[model samples]
Target chain A: MIMQTIDLEADGLRALNATLHAQKDDTNQTSWEVVNAKGSHAIAVGLDAPIEVTVRGSTGYYCGGMNKQATINVQGSAGPGVGENMMSGTIVVEGDASQYAGATGHGGLLVVKGNASSRCGISMKGIDIVVHGNIGHMSAFMAQSGNLVVCGDAGDALGDSLYEARIFVRGEVKSLGADCIEKEMRPEHLEILRDLLERAGADAKPEEFRRYGSARQLYNFDVDNAGAY
Target chain B: MCGIVGLFLKDKSLEPKLGEMLTEMLVTMTDRGPDSAGIAVYGADAAGQGKLTVQSDDAERDFASLAEDLGTAIDAKVSLYQKDTHAVLVAPADKLDQMRQALRELRGNVRVMSAGDTIEIYKEVGLPKDVAARFEISKMGGSHGIGHTRMATESAVTTMGAHPFSTGPDQCLVHNGSLSNHNSLRRKLRREGIRIETENDTEVGAAYLTWKMQHGSTLGQALESSLEDLDGFFTFVVGTKDGFGVVRDPIACKPAVMAETDQYVAFGTEYRALANLPGIETARVWEPEPATVYFWNH
Candidate 1:
């Protein structure tokens, strides 16, 4: 594996993304390192190749957005919208994530080793997110389809107006949003949790977590359920 | 989308560099808000004197002998330090209210930017770089400060519309998000005798805190109540005589990143503003939670 180090400060964000986008499956530069990220926006966005990119420092908005077939690793914290609309990729944050992490992602695995801010996995679709620490309010809000696993506490109104998303939380939830309630964890969920925990490097037992999902009553417009709307 | 940057120095060694540090932080967020810029610096307080930072559209005519003229009117000794379109008048602390009254009568066009023992505010309608350069804010020294770059959503792009609205002595606030109920709140605060200047939403927020503090509430308590009373999205960074505070609305969609070292506590709308701070690599960086108040005092 070849490693290429690009100074984000000197090379600029456009050049860095262009270089990363130039890589093909057979490209020798399989691993790329971005230094001096310095909280700039839109780093490593819209990549189609199956290459691994590592960001050394913190980032600004929309890092690794619209990712496809790329494994991006942020050694530091990420700003809003990390791994947004990702399709078949893995993005790992060694530090915390700002709001809306993995929002509207289609298919991917996003691992946040530290705490995640509000709206984590919001409007998510088919993405699997594993958070090792606490998550802020309104996580998985209006989530269409996904698996959100939290190893620690969740903030207020978790999973409001959810849709077919499986949420497994090992710690306390401050409050649940409308149409969301606790569900019984079965054998398949435990197996999925175990596999995700192993892959995300989390140190928690699968059985310790509880499952949550939509009650599905508000799917259709009913006058009796008007208050929940 | 406005941008706010605040620095509260815990270490005295960083005092002289406060303006330089805040200037860099503020200018980095110029793209966030480019209509106007402002800064509030809390410098060293004199033993028995207060400084009033005043701005005038016609600085050359209005600020010429206004200090000497106001001193005679208020029966006190006053000294003036002029910076571009603004001037800082140092007078007796007790005579500040008299000075305020006298200045209003003396020059109808001059506006008091701020009045307090140590706090001096300078804001203007321009880009952050030009505004900071006009006031030479980078050359000023202080213990703590807050700066803002405005995008001008709520009100017109004018000098008064720029942020760092100081409704109380030694108190200033800069906001990132818009307030929905500021017009009504402005009327209420005006009825309660709080001097709110502009139609800008942030001025109402500043006046709201000033009113709360005047009603025997601490700055922390005032901010806590603001979460309940103030309607709309806001990420407010406030500065007092000896304190700095940060608070966001319940549905905090606006961005706020904070970094704390043993030396200082810093706030920025984005991490890029704080990226150049000293010891930031090892600083405890995090986002201020929604509906949470984080405050530090000297």
Candidate 2:
């Protein structure tokens, strides 16, 4: 199928996103290129079909938010809430992303080639996030189910109040949050890490990473762990 | 949410573009804060001269003959330059306090924004674009500056409630989050005799830094102490006569990005605010660490 190209500078955010929404359920119109984005907000939100979107420049808040089967690519840096609450499909950011990237996402594969700011993947459920560079504090906070792969460092209070989500980091961890701790990397975990790295197109080997998860100490209310509350 | 942008030029060649670049960065954050806006520019200083940036709801009544009135009251030369709702009063360096006191006695509605040899603050209750255009910010030149767009989570939405609050001479601060202990801290700082004009929580934060620096702490030390003293989720960007600093709370709930090159050091609430800056494509960009003070001095 022939791909459609939308210039954000000429068409504006309303027209460009309206066109994508109109073609959401049409499988034939599968490919799109968005040029001159220039930090516009809320691009390609609530897409429900398996389409391909490429954004040429940096975007503002909530870019590619609440997606369900479309693949979105941002060639430059992104503002806050990139791929927020995404249910399924893929979002790739070739440059750095601001705070709360992939926040509260349910299901999808989000790839960040550069650093992600504070609170990356907070409260994520079932989504798989792969970041090639460093991630900031409070990442994966209260996450229920998902996989977060970081090729570089993780900042203060990583995986705070985590629940069921798996975290893998290749570099130094500044600090860990309550009920979250380092666990031994088994063979199966290594295989999963390798798969995630390959899928995210990262160069680092899976063996260099360490695993972190909930310690299960704070799973239930107890007098012994009352101080943790 | 609030937004902050700071730029410190290390190379003299970029001085001419300081206001233009800062204005663009400030406008990009209009979504983060749409209620009010402000900017603080550190221009070249004249020897033995200081400037007082003052705002009045009735500029016509208060600023019509303010220079002459203040000049007579303080027994010195005072030149007033009006820009819409604000005005800059240049006076003898030694007579700044006297001039401030006289202005207070003369005009009850006048509020001093900043008084320094190099700093001139212009802020109002409007969008960033409108505020910048009102003050002709894009045409001004300086070595460094800081700008803020306020969402007004705390206090009333008045002209004095806007950000880039300057409580000390040549000192100003912009904040992105709320300060939980501002009421108690405001009283404490007031006891210490730091001049605070607004009920805005950000003003208390700025006054705290000014008090600390007055008590012999450096800008970096003052910011470091803020992590322990101030209670709340906050990201602070501060400007002094010759320095710029940034700090985030331990929780780091607010977003902040910094970029640096040999020519300059720039800060923004998001990377998009810094994307259009010169040498940004190759600049070293990263998120400031939690509870750590990052500062640069010329």
Candidate 3:
């Protein structure tokens, strides 16, 4: 696989991303190096082919938004919506990430080696997010499906209006949101957590973390749940 | 959405580079807001003297010979320095109120942005880089400063509506979210004798903090009180005579990042705003928790 180097400082964000989007599936280019990111927004979006892209510096909003099959790596921090609505592939951030790191993602692996700010995984569908550091408030809000693993503390309202998503936290949870409750970490859950931890290169043991999910009481409409609404 | 950037130098050796570093941080957030921009700088203050930063739409006509006229009217020594649409008038500290009153009666078109011993504010309706260049923000030196770029969701785009609203003598605030109850709050604050100039919701937030602090609450306490009093999503970066403080609403909706190093403490709506700081690579960066007030003082 030949690697292509795209310098954002020289080529600009739109041109570089446009070139990546234009590549054919059978094209010889399979890897890309993005130099001097310097906090540019929408660096890579809507790629369907299996390619590897490495960003050399910090990025602004929506670094890998709606990614399909590209493995994106940020050597430094990222702004909001790191992998928003991603369908498949992997995104790894070596430094901290801002709000809504993996918002509404469907099927992908998003890993943040440092802290993720507020609403880290809001409305997640089927994505797998692993944060090695703390996460801010209202993370995983109204999540429909997916897995979020936080190795550090989570701020207020961890999972408001949660649905079928599974949350694993290794540190303290300030508060849980409505309909989200702490549940037992069963043997099969530990096995999945261990795999996620290993895949994300997190050092924490799976057994040390706790699990949280929807209470299922709000899943069906009932007169008794009207007060919660 | 709006963008805010603040820098408070812990090391005086980095003072000379404050404006340049802050300008870079502010310009990086141009995409977040494009309507208007403003900045407040805390420079060296002479004892017994205070500064009044004012802006006029017609700077040429309003600022010409204004210092001479103000000195005669208020019976105090006044020195004026003009930069683009803004001017800083230095006068005796004891005569500060009299000078403000005289200016208001003499020039109805000039609005006082701030009056304090150390602070000066410059703002205009334009892009952040253009506004910064118009005021020559990079050429000035200060110990600390704050900047804001507005997208104008809740108010009109006017010069007086720009951010870094200075409702207190030595204090200002730049906010990134809207206040749901600003109309009622504005009326209430005005009923209490708090002067608010613009229809901008952010100005009401600044005025609320000033009113709280004037009633003897410390800056941190006033910020703490705002978490309960101010309604709606907000991330506020406030500047005082010798301090810089940050606070987010209980829900923590609007984004805010803080970085602290041996040389300086910086605040931004996002981390990219802090990327160009002097020692940011080694700085301790974190998101300010919801309803928490973080402040640093000289």
Candidate 4:
């Protein structure tokens, strides 16, 4: 595998993304290193190749967003909207993540080795997120379909107004939102949690976690509650 | 959206570089807000001396001989240092009130930016880099500082609308979001005799903190109360004589990132503003939680 080193400060973000987007499925440049990331937004975004990019330092907003078949790793903390709307790829953050991590994604895997800020995995669609540390408030709000696994504590209003999404928590939840309640973990959920934990390098056991999902109350449209709308 | 940057130094060795570091951080946020910019620096204080930062659109006519007139009116020795459209008057510490009153009577058009023993505020309607250059902020030295780049969501683009609004002696506030109930709150605060100068929402925020502090609440306590009192979104970074504090609203739609090291404590709307700070790679960085008050004092 050939390796490419791109200096972000010298090459510019547009040129770097263009280079990554130009690669085809059988391209020999499979590995890329980004130096001097320095909290710039939209690094390696909109990539459809199966290349691997490693950011050398902390990044600003939307790092590795809308990724497809790419494996991007951040060596430091990530700003807001990391891996947003990603499709069939993996993003790993060694440090903490800012707000709305993996928001509105259709399919992918995002692993945060450190804590995730508020609105983590909000409105997620089919993305699997594993946080080794705690998650902030309103995580997975209005989530249509996904699996959000937390190895640490969860903040307020976890998984509010969800639809068919599964949430697993290994620590105490501060408070649950309307219509979101804990459900009994079955064998299938345990199996899914075990696989996600192992893949994300989390040390917690699947049995130590609890599952929470929507109570399906908000989905009904009743004539009696029309004024509340 | 607006941008906010604050630096509070724990090590004395970093004191002289405070302004330079803060200027760099403020300029990096130009993309967040490009309409106006302002900075507040808490510099060294001399015994028995207080500093009054005043601004005037007509610097040539208003600032000249204004110090002599103020000194004569207050019957105290005074010295003036002018920068861009603002000037700092160093006068007797006990006579700050009289000087402020006398200046009001002497030059009705002059605006008092800040009045305290250690604080000097410089702000204007320009890009952050241009504003910092006009004030020579990089050359100035301070113990701690806070800066803002305004995008003008709630108010007009004017010198008075720029952030780092100083409502109390040695206290300044920079805001990133707007307040929904500022009009009603402004009326109430004015009924209680708090001075609010503009229709700007952030001025009301600064005045509210001043009102709370006047009623014997600490800065942290005042900030904690603001979460309940002030409505709409806000992420505020406040600078006082001895401390720097940050507070975000309950929703926390506005962003704020904080970094703390043994040498200093830094706050920015994003990590990009803090990328150039010394030892930042090793600093403990995280986003400030919602409706929480984080403060550091020297």
Regions more than 4 Å wrong, model 1 = none
Model 2 chain B: ten consecutive residues of lowest lDDT: B280-289
- lDDT tens digits, residues A1-229, model 2? 7879998889888998888887746568899999978677898888888889999878888999999999999998888899999999999999998889999999989999999988999999989999999998889999888899999999888998899999999999999999999999999999998998999999999899999999988888889988876
lDDT of 3 by residue, B1-298 (tens): 8999999998998888888988999998888899899999999979999999999989999999999999999997899999999999999999999999999999999999999999999999999999999999998888999999999988899998998998588989999999999999999999999988878899899889889988999878988999888899899998999878888898787888788999988998878788777777678887788888888899
Listed in order, each prediction's TM-score against the native is: 0.99, 0.94, 0.96, 0.98
Q: Write the per-residue lDDT of candidate 1 for residues A1-229, one digit (tens) a residue.
A: 7689999999998999999989987887888999999999999999988899999999989999999889999989999999988887899999999999999999989999999999999999999999999999999999999799999999999999999989999999999999999999999999999999999999999999999999998899989999987
Candidate 2: tens digits of C-alpha lDDT, residues B1-298 = 9889999999999899899999999999898888899999999989999999999989999999899999999999999889999899999999999999999999988999999999999999989999999999998899999999999987999788898988578988999999999999999999999977778898889889989999999878888899999999899998889978889998887888888999999999877689789888788877788888888899
Q: What DockQ does each candidate score versus the true complex, computed on alpha carbons?
A: 0.89, 0.45, 0.52, 0.87
Ranking by DockQ: 1, 4, 3, 2
**Clash pairs (backbone) in predicted model 3:** none
The local distance difference test score of model 1 is: 0.94
- Per-residue accuracy of model 4 over A167-225 as CA lDDT, tens digit each: 99999999987678999999999999999999999999999999999888779987764
Query: What tens-digit string does per-residue lDDT give for candidate 4 at B81-141?
Result: 9998999999999999999999999999999999999999999999999999999999888
Model 4, residue B17: displacement in angstroms? Answer: 1.2
Model 4 clashing residue pairs (backbone): none
Runs off by more than 4 Å, candidate 4 = A223-229
Candidate 3 deviant stretches above 4 angstroms: none
Residues forming the 10-long window of minimal summed lDDT in candidate 3 chain B: B274-283
Error of 4 at B224 (Å): 1.5
What is the CAPRI rating of model 1's predicted complex?
high
